[model samples]
Target: MQLQTIVPIKPLGNPINYKAKIVNIGSCFAVNMAQRLQYYQFQNTINPLGILFHPEAISRLLEFVVNDKVFTQEDVFQHNEIWSCFDAHSDLNQLEQEDIIEQLNSKICRFKANVFDATHIILTFGTAWVYRNKQSNQIVANCHKVPQNQFEKELLAVETCLENLKKIEQNLRQINPNIQIIYTISPVRHIKDGFVENQRSKAHLIAALHEYLEKNKPLNYYFPSYELLMDELRDYRFFGKDLIHPNDLAVDYIWQKFVETCIHSNEIPTMKMVDEVQKGLVHRSFNPYSDAHQQFLDKLAQKIDVLLEQYPFMNFR
Candidate 1:
């Protein structure tokens, strides 16, 4: 008898090889996956505008980048000595408004380049609930600790999600005709939205995402990350202290499942070698002048040299 339910994930037609350039955008989970890809030294960019959680915010940001929409003074507001932009996350907030504008535009340049050049784009949507600034009537990526009354919180309609997906598809494909998009609903639960509301929000996302996939069959795909957490893990132990986010162990499990499903089989050996080099780089030496430690450093350098020779674009730093 089986003790656990397994999720059968089909490999993509065009696998991610060393040559594949990737960009991961959207929620914190996207950052989690991108860090793993970074560990293996894959050519990729992660959350250039920082961790955007909603489909509309991500959709708007992508549209801005592809259209070369630059941020200006009118776009940001000063809050408690820090300047913040509704278009981006708090990570871009700065002491000066001018500094924030410059930072936002610089990140946009990189995001635009990655949008055009990436072979694979992974987007993780964390919520369908969005907060719109009452004054501007625009969905804000983050509230930045502003008072609740300043914004109106509403669940994004299914049609609205569908529209954003179409906008993302149209804008991206217009530039990078061959780009492949992998959509994952983040496993992080928004319990603060209330239990029933959280389920309703996820329901909207799942329906909209699947509808988009069914209609636009060519370029989009979905990985059942939420399902994996809900079905396979199915325990409070898989959650962190807050109980809203997947714990490190759960994230690692999902990542390993992701590798087996999405990553090319041919690259596994390279991944193993990269892992060895990474572990060696972090290994602590008991004696700074010891011969054994010196030999270990030499071997680590040799492995790095071999990888560099094979993939000239890869850098350990």
Candidate 2:
């Protein structure tokens, strides 16, 4: 008897290889994929503006980057003795207004440069629920622990999200025509938004993503990450303590699926070698100066040298 239901996913037409430059934005789950890419020494840039959870937040950043818009002093606010901008996550919050403004603008410049050469751009949307700042009548990426009364909570309409996403895609393509775009709904559950509301949020995101992908068929792909988690790994054991986030095992399983579908077949051997090297680097030896351990180190060093000689950009460490 079959044990578990599997989600069918087709391999990407243009798979990402070592030569491909990749940029990932949106959602903390993007970090999971970016971390794997970093581990295997793939050319990857992730979330320059930080972990933005909604499409509005992501589109806002992309719009600013494409237009070369700079955040002025008025765009920032002082809250809890920290200077920060609502357009970016709390991670970018700084102590000085000048520091935050410079950081945001610098990140936008870096994003422009990165996307210009990116071979693949991956966007992960976490939620459709958004918070609109009452003061400026604008949606904010993160509230940064501000009082709940200061913002109006809202669910983004499918039409609004679809338009924003299209704008983002158009802006990105203008800067880099050859770049392939991938979209996925984050599997992380927003339980705090209430279970039914969370489902509603995901429904909107899924609808918008499918509509976008259908219209822009070429060079656009959608990986059913949300389906994979909800259908394939339906057990609560796959989630962390809060039962909202994917655990390490679940993340690894998703990453394996991601590689299976998105990575070039030719890169498998090199990935294996890299995995071996990574494992060796982290392996612990009981004897620090034994001849056998020394020989092992020498062999590991040789393996690293061989890989690095061909792919000079890859760093074993």
Candidate 3:
């Protein structure tokens, strides 16, 4: 008997241009992608409040929105001042009742309300696993030093994830029905989890996300950051010493693939073009550096000069 192999669907053409206001949510990998977009002068927002790694942050955000509060960076810094507030001598209940925390909560609520107007919403799920507080019936972003034994647990179901995503989409659509949603599975490995478990976890997220995207059609799309890293550049050289996160070179490679697959579908631009684009936009001030670093910058400058000669368009002057 002959068996047929199923092939994955590839992205069809250049990314459709829409003057987009983008919001990125989920794991650290989302941060990396957001940085790349910002580098390219794309209007994008990645967690306006900052790194939201746990369930408490999510809940707090909702609470803030509902209450009509304004948040500043100082407020967030104060919230995360401790390593784990739940473990500290301070009273958790009292802290929750504080006026500042309440104010911060209101701000988060407003942010969520504003998100519905975003032109594009991008989410990257890091894991299916989540911590839950049984008594409170709420998701906890972090255990907050609560004893591992006492902290309740729940693994997010594929169905639950899909439902949540649908709700998020629905809410956004109410504000702007034409908004587009993009989902990506973060490629950064979870080193805290054992290697075997990490792989299993990633597989679960990817499978769930893939199925969800397929069922939803054009309203949602999946970007292949995970596949590009795991399949194309699987070598150790692409990873940092930590063995979990991609090194600078790996990130650049994945970014190139992203541009190729999503931004320019037909022809990949030359490295010289990439460099020229970067230099044209870079506004950083040069500082005195050691001989080695200076040498590297000097070589880069020379290459830029040569490329300018070859392609006069690269000369901003």
lDDT of candidate 3 vs native? Answer: 0.59
What is the TM-score ranking, best to worst? 2, 1, 3
Report the C-alpha lDDT of model 2 over 1-317, residue by residue, as the tens digit.
98789999988899999999999998999998899999998999999879999999999888888899888898899999999888888899999999999998899999999999899999999999999999889999999999999999999999998998898899889899889998999999998999999999999999998998889989999988899999998999999998899999999999999999999989999999999999999999999799999999999999999999989999875
Which regions of candidate 2 are displaced past 4 Å? none
lDDT string, candidate 3, 201-274, tens digits? 77767766677667777667777777777877778888889888888897887777666555533223444344
TM-score of 1: 0.98
Clashing pairs in 3: 54-141, 55-140, 55-141, 56-141, 64-105, 64-106, 64-109, 65-109, 65-110
Q: How many backbone clashes can be found in candidate 3?
A: 9
Ten contiguous residues with the weakest lDDT in model 1: 6-15
For candidate 1, write residues 202-247 as lDDT tens digits: 9999999999999887867788889999999889999999988999
Best by lDDT: 2
List the global CA lDDT of all models: 0.90, 0.93, 0.59
Of 1 and 2, the candidate ranking higher by lDDT:
2
